[model samples]
Target chain A: MTSTETHHAAGAASSTDAPAIATWLTTADHKQVGRLFIGTGLVGLLGGLVLAVLVAFERIDAEGFQLLDSGSATQVLSAARLLLTFGAVAPLVMGLAVAIVPLQLGSRSIAFPRVAASGFWMWLTGLVLSVAAIIGNGGPSGGESEMVDLYLAASVVMVLGLALAALSIAVTGLTSRAPGMGLLRAPFFSWSSFVGSIALLMSLPVFIGTSVYLYVDHRYARAAFGGNFGVNNWVGWAISQPFTYVLAIPVLGFVLDAIPVLGRTRLAQRPAANVAVGLVSVAILASLTHRAVTLPWEGDGFFSGLGTKIADLLPFGLVNVIPLLGLLGVLGLTMLTLKSAKPMLAAPLPFAVLGLLMILLGAASHLLYTVEDAALGGTIFEAGSYVAVTFGTVLLAFGGLTYWGPKLWGRRIPDKAALPLALLGFVAAALGSLPYMIAGFADQPAGVVDGFAYSGPQELWNVVTTGAFALMLLVSLAFIGLAVRSFTAGEAAGDDPWDGTTLEWATSSPPPADNFSDLIVVGSEYPLADIKNSGKVG
Target chain B: MLTLPPAPQPAPKRQVFVGTALVSAAATMLVGGMLAIWSQFRADAPFRESPRRGPIKDWMPKDIVVPEVAANMMLIAFFVVCVMAQWAVWSAKRNDRQHAGMALGMTLLMGLATLNAQLFIWSQMGVDVRGGAFNSMFYAITGVMTFLVIAGLVYTAVATFRYLGRGNSDVPTLSAHALYWYFLTAAFSAVWFVVYVQK
Candidate 1:
């Protein structure tokens, strides 16, 4: 038995003590379930990357390589989006939340363990059915009507699974904290997860409603969305300027949680950080404005009337700039925290810094996009800026896995391989997105298969984007390889490897079935730090 | 040997109540979104004539026919079910098992009636679901609510059976179930006003 098992042998009566395939499949242990979520999400990432590469290859040539017909291209785009947004990034954050929140809260297990496990399975089923429908040339955009039904059904099921998981996580946060770990004192990630879960709970059902309408429209009543709604509109907000930032809110939480720990100091303005996270949740309302960015309805129609009404009722500038406010709030808090202490050059720092920088770039671009100006509305720049921001979450998720690897798996992902790959990831992301933003400004239209015959700069930009996409694929594969190797063969990481400030570091690496050997009632944000320095915990 | 602290068990009752509340909160957002679409389709303009009031032939392809009176009847039935559900909760809280059981049974009956009313409305509609956005939305909103009503009915049935059979039930679960019934009542009323009365 391992040292952790030997130490906790008295309390090791559960099935988690037996590390077998059956244990993994059937275990309701939050840690095991979390690992399953992360692993499944990785599979999704690989699939999304392959699809992205195909799309990029098509974009490489102006005549748009006839590798897939336009309908098939639409299918690929939809599938890639579902895989990345739901399959990869959302699950990754959820996995981290599931694994880390309870431990940070000093709770032994997640609330509603069976519900969470069921959610994971449901999510997998939904993802498989949706992807299968796409592969079979039966998606919402596909020619076959039945495929469209499959797409709608599968997507709704997938969202329901996520909603279930979010409910479990949110409930655990509300009622399962350790004796004295109040809301303010709860670790940043756990608190952030709670907020993000609430946001997901609130937003996903609206999408489900939309999907239900689509299903009804496609199946029985052919009247709604005016034949315009499909997979494209389902993710339109997700790929667009403002609402896409809603997806990045949790990454900001990761940064908030990591900054104080990486700096080996207390956060500068903890309440303000919490408020900023709250502001990000509030920013979800502004997402409705994304429709205005693309639609040219200044004079007539319901959209114009509603837009004018909304502008009059609310602070137009403030509502439009909610994401900017949230991101800047994070940046300001980060700078304040770094100012108070000497930050060590560590594994998470590069990922944290680069991720935030890319996110900022995306937010800045959004600020410009939300402007009344229509010049850059339909350009390749729209896609470019989106790629930068959405991928920022990808970078942050990688860093989170690294930052919490020891606590999660009893080993650290070797910095020798990880750090360099982290840098390469940032480089590829910048190269991939910056050119598109520039090309977009040059009047290069988006959603085009072939290069426009009239535009010179669009071709040059597409070539650069294609090359950058290839490089991104290479870096991603290498990073995944390094992570797998670390899981199997990396050196052991003892408890508190980086001298973390949170409660999670107080336990053994790959903490035993029981999270802590002893209960430590936390009175401050940095509970472990206090215990190590003063020899007493609150 | 390092003796770890035993893990604390979560309060399952509290978890159930919280989970129900959260789901109800999410349901509110869905209603809001559906209303947003309804408003957009109505267009609210001087040039756009009332499609419902126009010649029946003009409503052939895209416009859907809504059964206004039947929808209003469903709303009233749902509201009555909600009242019975609240009575069940109140009786349960007071440890009045006999009253709670009767109230819950009534809730189940009313919920079934509401579902029946919905189906009757669908059967009575002049156009099928393929009629267009208005028809599609009419089905979508009512269809989703019908499912919720079925769910509430199952919960009420279980709560009623548990209370009647064992002289007790999980009060928290029952209460939470009632809360969802209340939500369904409010939601149906709002949808009724927008889709039927206002139009």
Candidate 2:
């Protein structure tokens, strides 16, 4: 191929030359692929939020079925959980990593760009089929066996797609660094993405293996695993506490990356930040041990032996404590960074900080949920934790979009408009989750629309939770509107709007097809800072 | 006098070997998780009274005895497969295209032999999948092994074709193919120990 043909093959040509839809379909550009993932992920978030609102509304009456029936209530809950974690949060985080990690690493393109593109399409197809199967009564507790099989099979495909994308991202981080830039010296976002992608790649397969078993047993015989009713029991670990935190792993990366830049200072304790991210990924180990190892805490032989008690408590303590320590470490590091820095009251800053706070709250709640005396398992408290992680991830993703929207679209999302949405999101996440948690203590059962009595004022809590979901739904819609409006027609963002120190800031607002027009060789962690200090560019 | 700046150096391209290693690690974990589940189920299953035998504690159905010879043969084939895969990688590194091609072909043959052996074992067992938990999990575990073998075969073939088509040895592709086979060998070893021998 000619050089120009080669360039076009590499997705260097502008979309205007060819049909836009065709260009997108065939494009191998990480930016375009990232945009596709982000767009679809937002749509997924909106759908999941709608379902969540429906679920919360159903719970409002507490004694009667409102919008969902007893038969389909659990399935809808499963669907909402499925869509929020796999469909929405994972894709959103993976999208940001795919689009920005290469740029941060100063590489011309993402590794296996075509593979990443294929991953997006495959994930989308699986997501669509999964939703369709759920609608057809094929999810965990669906009545139809075939649809349940479809959901299982489709979920495997979805997970594989995400895994493929993660492989590309992880490989890119490992192999695509610019000259003189080591892994430790790479930006916080890139480092955390590398770690998070590996975590996803490792943990997601267990889900796939479990799903395979579920599929075969459900398809062939209902003997091995509980056929339909057993679906959640087998795979629910992926969307619950600790595992749900897997989706939030990259949230810390975004928070760390955005805080220092918005504060207009270098991050304090950079290594600690990296360690915190790695510590969070350690939860993947906890997730893997979920069904494989049983914690015999509920047995009647209460205090069998000291060794037995220690062994039982060890896994629980390690599982709950490690990720919590990671979040606490992040909180401490963020505060330390802000203490000495001249901070800007930017939209992304509040979003990042508040998002981190919400995730910390979620982790703390998970630690509490593990207490045997709490009796929080199999309660809406689990839903509360899921909401905090899922919505916290949403908030972080929005912050990422706003922070990097300039680089992505050559326009800034109006900060004044976005700032309030961040606060609203925090409120929604807090209200949506905390009330459910309180009701969990009140003995509200999980995965039920009706037919349960609790002494606690479950109705009032559900009413508040419903209102919270409504607020969250509004926040999601408004954020989408802000993104669309800003990306299409907003104030022009210069090459380095935030006066950033990273390689991404060194390039044009919307980078060229090859990302950089010239080779960028880094000499320090802050390459742009080095250049500025040397007076190479003003 | 006007001076021209030096040309820019090209960026480092993607490394297939690194990608392959990551993929191999994930595949290992996938098989490891399945095997763990299999062990969990076996430990949990209660002893059943067989018509021919008094009380069998085995997870496998009493009527069907796992074809030990076939399973052992498959395990042996994988060991040979790994050696041949490494030989191919060695030849490719030395630019010995003829030897590399032969080594890869041998690896493919051995892989197919393993697959054939596994099929033989399945046919000999003839256990109904709907029989019970043991039967269901048996298929789940062995079915995944079959899929991995097929994937490894396709990978080897692509490497061989690429080496022959270009009339040159591509060390990275060959090395990655070797790593994948090694992973397969390890996975099958676990399968043999846990499912075939232990049962």
The CA lDDT of each predicted structure is: 0.75, 0.86
Instruction: Please report, as a residue range, the 10-residue window in candidate 2 chain A with the lowest summed lDDT.
Output: A1-10
| Structural similarity to truth (TM-score) of each candidate | 0.89, 0.94
Q: What is the DockQ score of candidate 2, to 2 decimals? A: 0.62
Clashes per candidate, residues 3 or more apart or on different chains: 9, 2
lDDT of 2 at B76: 93
lDDT per residue as tens, model 2, A39-90: 9999999899889989889888867556777889989999988888888898
Which one wins on TM-score? 2
Q: Report fnat in order of the candidates.
A: 0.82, 0.65
In terms of DockQ, the best-performing candidate is 1
lDDT of 1 by residue, A285-370 (tens): 66553263332335455665886756543554555566577778888898888898688777677788788888788878766655
**Candidate 2 docking classification:** medium
